[model samples]
Target chain A: MAIRWIALRIIQEIIRDRRTMAFFLLVPIVVMTLIYYALLEDEKAKLGVVTRGVARFYEYPLVSVIEEDEDIEIVSLDIPDKETDPAELDRLIMEEMKKGKAHGILYMDQQLLSERFAGERGAIHIYLEGSRPTSTAAIFSSIAEAMDDLTETMPVVIDAECSAKCANSVNIKAIEIKKHYLYGSEDYRLIDYFLPVFPTFFVFFFTFIISTITFQRERVRGTLERLLIAPVSFSQIILGYISGFIIFSSVQALIIIGYILALIQISFTPHQLFALGVTLFLIMIVALTMGLLASFMAMNEFQAIQFIPLVILPQIFLSDMIWRIESFPLVFQWISYGLPLTHANIISRKVMLQNQSLWENWPQLLSLGGFFLFFMLVMSLVALKRNKNN
Target chain B: MLKIEGLTKRFGKLTAIDNLNLNIPEGLKFGLLGPNGSGKTTLLRMITGLIEPTHGKITLFGKWTPTSRMIRRRVGYMPQQTAVYPGLTVSENIRFFGRIYGLSGRPLEDRLNDILELVELGDKKKEVLSNLSGGMVRRVLLATALIHNPPLLILDEPTAGVDPVLRLKFWDWVDLLVKQGVSIIITTHHISEAERSDQVVFLREGKIIQQGKPFDIMKRFQANNLEAAFVRSTNLK
Candidate 1:
């Protein structure tokens, strides 16, 4: 009955509260739809390519080029020693590369223009720096195809003619490669990657929404005093609250998971579902801890609301929703590991997408559980001490 | 019954309740009257276990130190302000505090009906606290404090902003609670209400300047009203 009454109050409190409605129910779905459309649905990757003699070939009808005003940030490094310069100019170019001012550099040797080189054995030497690997690969493939077209017009040399044991090496052969998938096809889009994170994201959003606003309201409304005086021990109250939110957050998790699986057809392994369950549970605990901390710090609801960007934005970014930890610097990986959501992401991806077992993830599961328990203990103590002192 | 000995509370350099002591047996309506900063609320808060007195012993019903939950269940506290949830309806607010005291079902419903009638807020039970008038909210706060039928009731300022008609009715309700063996501790500036108290303790600067039956104290000060007597006592100090 106590749980039911409190749950009813929690429901009523959220339903009547406009900010609560906005943050929990509306924001997650809005952001998810927007992110899905902004990143995956009909979105094109923008590349800045710097070309030397490969421009005409790149403009061919078979190539897909997405042109913006700032497309192809071309930088010309016209020098004999462009790749290995010892001059101040080379230092400046290296600085630009380090500062992300240049994506790729291509140097075309003037020897290609000579009529002597236009006959049987002449070729254009392409010196391309392959950093900014994606752009480099794109440019290299396009230029290499164009160069292959140039090579078609010239007579081929047989350098291995004296090697009698390899006489069939001169015989031309064409190989065709075909690819197939057993589960997710090659067309398994970017949302497949984002699908795993949506559960974590939604859980985080709802937990944060429910805990922060409710706890802040308790503090501001002065009913916290009433609770302090009640027969319910502070720890019990905290425990009850944590349990209540966990119940609600689990529902939220199931809802989002169902949506992704049923409406969106995102494949998730049972282990991944288990990992997601653990993640949602951990997120609820983190939310309770954050809410208690926010309750202690914020003087009003507006101040508590300010914690959303300060708290949630970093979790979203560092939890590998859009970026991977290995792709980040070493220092960032350590920082991401320190975040609860990072563990959630690891466990969820491993279990859901990779089909890993729970026992194998005991280390992460224990760490997240330990963090929640430690926080619960600390928060309960703080709440007790604060109520005793206030 | 509540008992205090050598009760002392200090906020940094300033001592709020300085080595104080008081005792109120069951069924006694005790008044803790004091000027601003005289530690009236501070003392009530300590008794309710909201704040701990640094140097004193507090015994609730002969227990040396009462746990918060135990004292909270039996002792009703109405803070100086209307501490009810402004968003909740009056009956809902009462029901919340009632459930905190472990009251529910038919008993809780009956108690809710009784308290609303006691506070003369039967019609406003469905009204949100924020939507109610200040007087109505104050009455509802008193109703909340009394919802559990606690043996000890402390009203920080139960009659503030209340019209004289309701103020008289409020005291009459206190009298009824007293008749039912419930102890009452009230703080107020209304001398006429203080006159009706079973006992009054005048405090100044965290010290009890005078304490006795209200008419006796008035007679001792040669004043016709409790207000003049309070002024005389403070002036003498």
Candidate 2:
């Protein structure tokens, strides 16, 4: 009952604070929306569709969808009817691809469009620029969908598979994907890769900041001393802070994840969403404890901000949230071994993508739980020591 | 209710409190009078167990070392700062501090009303502490301290910055507490204010230069008032 009241009081205090409410509840979504558009939104994929059948290509049903995509600039290069050599047409497309002007190319067989071959099924060839694998993959799939629309009359051959000689094989009717995903389906987008980890980062960052400054303010305003003189124990105080702040932090994580999902349309099963929510709660608990421990060292709000560089930045730089962790050097990689976010990022991604349970991801859960317990113990010690006015 | 002997707190070369000895018995209104940096706060902090003494033998209620929780609950301490939560309303702050000291339900609500009446904050129960006047916030602080109804009340400079009318009201409540046999220990630099205590001491550099009733100290120093008596006691010593 006592712990409940303390927790309730803290929640009431934070809810009543307008500045804190704006930062925790409002700032994250606004900034996250900006980041979603800036980093993940694909507004500039260039695919060169090579075909003398310029008018025929516009007949593709998905052409309307493709045209509405302002991110992709489709420069239709005209080959001179059946008179132009097929090899010359493909060579021109490859030339444009090498210049990096087009990330992908679609070569429509001129013979298939001519009257002589009109009775026979036409074939289309897609060539993807090799520099950026993800962008190359996205453009390839988009063209595949466009050909899937035209597959009833024409056979589409990817650049790597079945050369132009096999394009007219009337036996095969539909597009065939030679490679399959071991994880997500071919329909997955680049934004899907980060859905799991971004939620964790958002939760950790906001919770760390709000918890630190608010705890420091408790000391600055002298309420900490007053609390010390109460019958409340140190452990109870830490528990109260955790219970108080975690309620809102969990809501923040869910709100961000839900908003991003609605905007980006990444489908998740109820089980996956639940796992994400649970993992976020665990990470938020870690952030809360870590923040309280740091607050003990800070005498003022500015000193609390000093912890951002000292702790938060280092954790972010070393974690997989920024980039692939393997790209980091040996010493820097070793730093991530100690940082709990590394484990959290890995675990959240696995849980959301692989549908791993708490037991399946026990090692990561143990590491994150260990960090949580370690910080909690340290926070208790710090809170107990600092309770007495110095 | 309190005892001290050889109580000394030294910050390296600087001794903040030195060889202080005093006894504050039950039902007595005691005051420690000193100028700024005269170790008044340090002395009060040590007694409240907010900070441990460097070298001292101290006892409260026959126990030389009370458990931390006991020390917290047995003494109602109101510091000079407005320790109430500024974001919380009067009723919320009252209930919060009361809950912290293990008060709740009917008894808690009753004490909240009683404390608001005592502090004369009966109408401001719904107002946030930050929006309250300085004197009102101080009253809220005192209400929180007194919420648990601890026998010993230690108010550190309670009326220091409060308006004159509020200070008089605060003293009137202190008189009521004394009549109820609640042991009260107050610290202040206001010599005239310290004169009303049953026993008062003027400390300098952590050492007691004057210890007696206010009138007796005035007679001993041959001064017309406590301010003059206080000036003579510290300067002469």
Candidate 3:
């Protein structure tokens, strides 16, 4: 009964604070929306084709074929016949790329054209402004598709003997590239691949911050001392707070999950969504307990916030969010395993994207439970010590 | 009733309470009088089990220590700081402490109303603590402590910032509690407030300089007021 009252009071206090409410509920939605647009929205890549000699005759057909792809835009650059310096042409292509007029440059010369007509394997030289990996990959795939189309529909202007000989020697579809997915489809964007991790991280991050600051404030304001003087035990206090924070954090989790799904327009099975919810709930408990333990070490609100770099930043960097944990060094991989977020990310990805059941991902789920227990145990010990000393 | 034997508390190199011994009888208004950092709060904290004594023992109502939950329920402590949550309504703050002491349903609500009336905050029970004035917030803290109706009440500077009118009302309320067989342990810097206590102890540098009935101490020092008596006992020219 005492625990229930304490939890109720905590809920009342937090609900009355408008700024904290906005930060807890609205900030994640706004941040996730920004990430969604930044990662998934693709713009058309412009390619500048420099054709010299006989290659100029292929430019119109090549551009027409590549332009069929919505993601690629082809621009034909005209150069005077006398200005045949390779360095000059290369400089011109580089200038176009630097000016942002083109994403890549395709150079097709006489030797490459004759080789193609002679039924020999020809090489196409392409220069790319390769700053962004996604854009670079997009440009390469579009050009590869355009080349495949060119081989299938050769220009009628080609000599009948050469065309017939080249067609007889080369199979039109020699390399049929087929795509098959074990889980997600070709329509899945980079953002969709990363979406499951965002809510897990936000739930953990915000809960930790709010719990730490609130616990620190309770200590500094002398309410904690008053509580100790009451009949309530330290464990009850910890449990009461956990129960209180869980109510709101659960709502926060639901908001983030619903908003992200609606914004990204992705559907999941009810069972998978339930599994994701369970993973996030466990993550919230771990975060809340960790924050309580941190508050035991902090004397004031500023000191509580100072723990962010020490506690939260490492989870962000090593939690397999930006880089896969398996790809990390052995030492870092071990550290990632120790963090609560790494387990949460792994479980969330498996359940949401891989269509895996919770039973199949029990190891990671068990690791999260372990982290929660460890944090709660340390927090109880610290609370006991603080009652005696402070 | 409370008894302390060789009670001592040290924070690293500084001894906040040193070899302190006192016996507080039941139903008496006991005042701990001291200047800043004189260990009055530390001694009260030890007696209330807010902190463990470095070396010694405390017996509360025949119990060996005051840390037991049953004993904790019988004692109420109001810290020097206004320790109420600013985001909660005044009624909510008082009711939370009441509920912690196992009061519930009609009993909790009745006690909540009684405490609010005693603190003269009945009309402002719905106001958030942060919206209240400093003195009103202190009253809310007092309400939370008094809401439990413990036999022994330990208040540290309960009327520090209260206006003169409400301060008198607080004394009246303390007098009423004592009259009802409640033992009150309080610390205050206000000399006049200390004069109302049945017994007062003057402490300096974590040691008791003088202790007895307020009138007896004044008489012994050949002084007209407890403040003058306290000054003479501390040897402050």
Worst 10 residues of 2 chain B by lDDT: B65-74
Q: What is the DockQ of each candidate?
A: 0.40, 0.33, 0.50
Q: Rank the candidates by TM-score, best first.
A: 3, 2, 1
Clashing pairs in 1: A272-A351, A272-A352
RMSD of 3: 13.8
Provide interface RMSD per model, one decimal.
2.1, 2.7, 1.5
lDDT of each: 0.68, 0.75, 0.80
Candidate 1 ranges with C-alpha deviation above 4 Å: A1-185, A246-248, A262-265, A269-271, A327-329, B123-131
When 1 and 3 are scored with lDDT, the better candidate is 3
Q: Residue A232 lDDT in model 3?
A: 89
lDDT of 3 at B94: 92
Query: TM-score of model 2's chain A, to 2 decimals?
Result: 0.56
For every candidate, the chain B TM-score is 0.95, 0.97, 0.96
Per-residue lDDT of A288-318 in model 3, one digit per residue for the tens? 8899888887755655776765678668767
Off by over 4 Å in 3: A1-168, A326-328
Error of 1 at A158 (Å): 12
Tens digits of per-residue lDDT, candidate 2, A26-142, equal: 656744543443344344577665445443554555455565665566765443556457667666666666565776766554444442233334455667654334555766667
